[model samples]
Target: MTANACAPTYSLPATSAPLPAPKQDPVRTLIDELLAEQQRLQTPVARFSEAHDRGASPALEPLYRDLIPLSKPGPGEQYAFEVDLDSCTGCKACVAGCHSLNGLDDEETWRDVGMLVGGTRNHPFQQTVTSACHHCADPGCLNGCPVLAYEKDPVTGIVRHLDDQCIGCQYCILKCPYDVPKYNDRLGIVRKCDMCHSRLAVGEAPACVQACPTQAIKIVTVTTHLNGQPALDTTAFLPGAPAPEYTQPTTRYTSSKPLPAEIIAADAATLRPQHPHWPLVFMLTLMPMAVGCFTVAACADLLAPRYPLLANLPASAPTTLALTGWLAGAAGLFASVFHLGQPLRAWRVFLGLRKSWLSREAVIFGPWFGLATATAAVPLASQLGLFSGSADVPVGSVSSALASAYSLLAAHYSLLTLATASVGLLGLFCSSMIYIDTQRHLWRAAQTIPRFFGSGAVLGFAILFAAAPTLPYFFALLGSVLFKLAIEARELRPLDSDDDTPTASFKTAQMLTGPLRLPHNLRVTSALLACILAFALTRISAPSLLAWTIPALLLASELTERYLYFRAVVAPKMPGVVSK
Candidate 1:
């Protein structure tokens, strides 16, 4: 304090210190603000611009509406997917039959047959499995569908697609190991056996079921099969059969003897052979990158304390950022490559602009992938070897400049990836918006995060967790599961909504706290008491009961929460019932 009194006033360092800055132009401010508004406006425009996103094209809706209700077995129309290993030759005749009748293209096979070889008789022991859709008791297809495009009749339980309403997300196909939903890139829609809806409406059998000359397939009600009837005893009802996990498909088939258990096992193994290839690869690629990506994100947060400053970050953070940003994206592209049957002709994938997220996903990621690569490599080169002894050393060297540019580019991709998630969320939002316009409180409410993030967190974790330490080499998966579980679990905790968001997921927490809470409470209390009695039991019980115990508690609580969300809210269709 005394120093001020002793010091003479130095002229305000007037080599002309920069003046205190004035407020910038409001026009500039508005323009800067418009950046995001510009983005929002561009999204709808981009959707319209895409050839495949048809996005309810007035032109296409009528065309789809014309094909609506699909020529299905109709609601409750019993349909069968039968295989005659004995009389049936692996001719793929039913496959071709389904195509011709359904107007499916060369790539789209409504039905296909596989060979299951078992029994001591070597070559002759092979049985042919010609299946379209098993229409299972639990159609994994129905449970996994995000758009709610699938509906099974309560009476007969025939699963059908609401063609006009379906967004063609391909999630149903992803859920079905059998790969029943066939995507038509030309139309950007999924084509599958609708149980010959039009024919079934008239009490006629579906094309494929009828086409089976050996009479291997027969359409029947769900009750007939689940009754522990003879139908369940046949080869048609073998373990791992095409039986869907949720829909309780009404279609039924008959067999002579449920082949020897070994043969049945072999046949079940043969039927659904499409092991998901991406999770393993993504785990390998993504896990390592998550470490890098997070480091990049975290470091950037530290260095750049502000928005523009983030753009000016050093190379190390960008390298990490770029690589991490690209991991999921590049992996997703790789996954899409394998998802298609003829990946060589993948260029044709882009041709359908009016109706494909797969296409949009492909389109968006292409540039994002390139930037991710260059950003990662250039920065890395400078960091390691590119600028060892230059005048500018590392920071001001030509290589460094290039590195900085790439680093910034990578950040943009990160933003774009967020945009992609937002786009997808919005697509789901559109699904909700569509339902809202209908005044359907059920769908309107169901439109919340549970459908996207909840289901995504659950299924993604399940898929991603398969690679957990005992699961896989990558923590990319486990970390995400933990992160998502932590965040989403919290989101599911509070029951907040008005029509505000429909059934609150937090209600699931309530269920766990109230009605369903007792079992877990007992388990927890008993476990605590048991620990006092014997700690060994806790370890033994945890893996066996508690592994599932925690997951089940969470899942049951969550699924019920989701179900309550679905059931409690009344849609306009079911008039006079108000949401509880």
Candidate 2:
């Protein structure tokens, strides 16, 4: 207390007054004033000249003058493009204008000009259609985004991509019908036409609109109901374009000249498969196969006691099953990282789980991986004598109790197996949904679900046959192989005549029979060989050689089958040059 009382008191210092900034030299001050006056006088004339250079003519200015107030739509209103197809020259001025004004990459374009041609030779008809982001009533890009990277303005209905928030997964590119969004590889993000929203906000038309020399492209106010007018119907679209009712695309195309009933895209006959996504192919194949392995082992163990055929088989050790599942699941997941433009930002994949099937796939697979790892680790821990068996000294009944618990856990291996099996199945389902959600004919659930699940079934049974040499397992493997082949064969059948659009069906068939024919033939050959080997392995005493060989053949066949699956898919895109 005495030492505390002896502490010195601090004194409060008086504050000084603030000093004013020094005055500029008279000569410099006079010069600055003169410069300001000169800039003010030059600004008005410069602005008018700038607008004139943007492709606005005297006749177009009145409409341009009136369009500014309506550019940014008010509440419950929406802005859309009205294209007068008759006046469009396919000059590509709009495309160039958008690219330059938006500062897009050299290889990237947000707008495109497509030619629709169809009519009698005597009355020939060809029309150029300029298309950009439709900003649809149901924006697929917005709905499919994993990270909520896309947003449609409630006020103006302008679809905008939030670049900083994007992980560059490219799911939106797949979802968009018009193919408006362009991925910037250097920036590791996606950018799209916002209809020059910044320009619109300042009472100016979009760059594309202003740049149209013939005034073919113009801004208009449309009711929220895209189907509000008959002009927006499917009949208005060019050939090979998706049905307007699907996304209710807001861009309206009109022409005074009557187009033929069978207008076709100039590039409709072009056969181009989506770029081979190697990481996706590996992840899709290996992860499901891993899940199948876990499920088969678990089911085999659970059913072994009940079924006579499953009895006395050489099932994989729990350690092997756990470890295989762990490795396969982890490897598939790691490989998927390379598929993203910004792999470092892959953690954002979970952000779109609510609406994006791609996100759901990530979320579900993550748990599957964790469970598999834990299952593998338990057996490893027991082997290392970390949980049970020979330790230095007994602590108490707790240690003895843990030792007994460990033994019980080791005995009840089916518990972890069942859990891993459950999660693996869920992961497979999520994977199927990733393609199913695209709504592409080739990737429909009827096609993708069966192929995906059947792959797991075939590979899982093959694995089970190897793990435990059993007749039922071999038979199951043989049956699944045949079933999968049947499904693929169905793809060869002529497309349904009753279906409204057969372009996709025709394109898919061409891909399968044309480019992928050799692979398809080899796949069937491999499957047949595997089946023959499986049958022969059952009869021979030393079946180890055949056991390993059959699975290898089966895996090769599966790889080929998956390659075709991706190779034959014709993703819907806006018509463009074949090289694009």
Candidate 3:
């Protein structure tokens, strides 16, 4: 109903129509009384739930108590999700169902089914698990996103991804252990199971549940006093994530197998990090590495101002590279927007502060980068004599704009400078978290010093490599070497634990190319040693092979470590185990 479309605000002085008291029709009066009571009760519930979710609840807080409020399903309410694991038969009917139902593009799915194989090898049985957004309570996706595009229905507890509010960073993919978020390369956005909330609001089951063959999927409300709990049979395919804290996932899986303890154990350490996306790291750090590389090149040129050609190059170089760098960063960032379910309306991010850092970061990011980018071009303008830096201007006056410009530039660059340092560090943090947070001893080794230092060194050297022609980036390469050593040290350390996982991984890595470690390592080490000695004999002058060899050895080791890392992940044997 349209707002203000109802009766006037002022109450009429008690209706003087008592003479017409409708002849006191008892049945009609009783019906009117009953309808009024029902409407009164429902209207309060509806209002409170909506208001409470928006954090503006006075009446809602008490009426609903702790229940979450869900956005009402769209008009013509029709929706339900149903699943039967026993008869699922490991087929993927629902995936296609979701794709078609949601008008998802090719290579996109609104729902999917994963297979979990268990029951001791001899009596192995495969369970086909269908899945989509559980619309979780305490959704890892919701918590981990830097953008606040997710919403939960107070009544239904249906967590929703608001397409219009998303920027498509795909951070949700990492935050979710189920691997639900799919990267739509074409759209340059991260898409996931939207839970068919729209359809559900309109009284329909999610597309996947509707499409499941054998009646394997179903919608249910397994109610108890507690809220946000999934329906009794509902299960998610989360791998290495938190325990089901009754986040009230609406989608439930009916599995024949009992839940495992090991998976639950992994969840303790693997609850997704609050800052999983690390927007600050990207904005403040990574962007600068590229920018700083250009900056350093600019400085190097500035230092050699005596060289006419070099000085002229510096004048435009910063501007040109700054523009290019911004473009690349912007391109990547823009592509990220299409990943949102609703791209056109993304400004909702700035509305919340205390509850959302994503909004906070986004609110500041564009402007911060904008100011920083312009500040970067300032020295360039100075080069062109656009304005004299030393020109006398009144201090403390907005007229000069100096105070304001200084303050703004200073404020902007603080975060922007931080962006530079933390980019690689945050990426490392993510890499470490991926391994450290998971339970596999083999994978956890990634938390060791080697990975920590090595990744930084490798990335640093890569930057150096790109900027090699101008001047020395040796310090960067030196970092690369130290990191390489750390990698070696991590490998040499005894398997983090004697779990069969590490042993299996090592054995697998060894046998991957026929036989095992001895052959693989021996071949690699011998070739590398030969090359190193040959270069040593060549006196590091003519070939410049020294530069290549250092990274090569470091790279080879990194590749080997990566190979092991890949082998180390222990996938629960399901017919359709998730892997990227």
Candidate 4:
């Protein structure tokens, strides 16, 4: 009992004071405070909305404040790009911004940067140029579109492409002097810079303007008229760019220093082949051949009865030729359909008939096809006894009516042939006008008119001679072919000139003799071969074989020539870097 009492005598400790809290690390304490503060902050969307409601300026406002106009354009005025050459450093930030903000394809850019170089050895100079759609006072793309796929805004004067309305004919590409409109392969349509129209509508600068670090590009109001009339003074356009007289481009390039007199594009000497446009090549070649056939058939039908040499022609010859022409025309028209990126939208091609030669060509050819079909089929129908009847049948009877109708058609058949040929000739004129209107030096009226019509004449005479094997047809073929070859040979004259300037003609000459020399030589060789075969046909009797061979050779020559037409011609553009 005593031991137990002693063991129970141990004392319990009293409640101890709280131990001192471990000191917090300074970095951790600061981080915790920041995390709590961040939790209380508003989201970016809420902040932006609050700022907008309070009329606070955007973060980017200061960056693009001077790049855009303070007010909209007034009467006789329009918005245009004004570039300060002295301020530009050739940085491609504008291009990147345009592509990103516009959501353009990876390889596509509305803005382009180029270099201009000139001056003597002692005073060499270089300038960087940035360019995009000029939004001209008179736009060639709008004027040449066969479907009205482009429009200039009435108030702002921005040239905008209507993507949905475009058939992707790309005629506007050829029409535009500065090569502004670009084709989008994925969309099967053309797209261009509309000056970031939607952004401008919301009082924001264009992507290019906003992103240019040096503030080299700016939007400004410019006078689009003179003496109260819509006229443009294009002297303010860039010096090393395409001529502004054609489209009246409004982009103004300013510099403190005067440009060199001999300033030229960096890429002026580069030789590159253009798109072949195979469908157009086929359409052009075949349609002209069809026109020639119809024309020759008409002439033969009219003169055969009067001239003894032609009188020997078989009665089926005219009908055969007309049929051949109709077939060719049909094939050409079909091939043209393939040329359109949006073939289904081509129904609207006639909408631009007021300004577009392509539209006129389409409209005129539609009826020409119908007339040609009738011309080809009517005679065949008569030969098949569809219009045959005894003249002595009772008057007013169907048989008597048929006989009368047949006789009337027989009397006016030559006239019908003449009319069809005339319409086709007119369509061909429209075709030639399509290229001539482009204002390219290689596609001027003098070159295009003769080339198109001459091709028709040569091909036509070749076909007629093949059918009749007559001396007149042979001579006509020889003369027409020789004339066409002579016209093509004139393209080489610039090569012999002492002047070494890289003008369009000189560039064309260089292209023909350079990379395109193989095709050019083949064209000439085929033409000569056709001529030789034509002469041989007169000496030898091999109508079936020579007929096909001669026309085939002529066709090959014409196709090659048309290929060279597109390949050798130098397109005018802004100065660019030398192509690798």
**Per-residue alpha-carbon lDDT of candidate 4 for residues 468-506, written as tens digits (9 for 90 to 100):** 775667788889999999999998998888998888888
lDDT of residue 527 for candidate 3: 33
TM-score of candidate 4 against the unseen true structure: 0.87
Better candidate number, 1 or 4, judged by lDDT: 4
Candidate 1 segments whose C-alpha is farther than 4 A from its true place? 1-93, 121-124, 164-169, 224-236, 239-251, 264-580
Reference-based lDDT, each prediction: 0.45, 0.76, 0.47, 0.85
Question: Order the candidates by lDDT, highest first — what do you get?
Answer: 4, 2, 3, 1
Better of 2 and 3 by TM-score: 2
Tell me which residue pairs clash in candidate 4: none
**TM-score for each model:** 0.38, 0.82, 0.50, 0.87
Per-residue CA lDDT of candidate 1, range 30-101, in tens? 768788686555322233345246565423432221112333433324445544455666666567667887
Backbone clashes in candidate 3 total: 45
Query: What's the residue-level lDDT of 463 in candidate 1?
Result: 25
Native-to-model Cα distance after best TM-score fit, residue 103 in candidate 2, in Å: 1.2
Best first by TM-score, ranked: 4, 2, 3, 1
Candidate 4, superposed: residue stretches over 4 Å from native: 1-63, 383-408
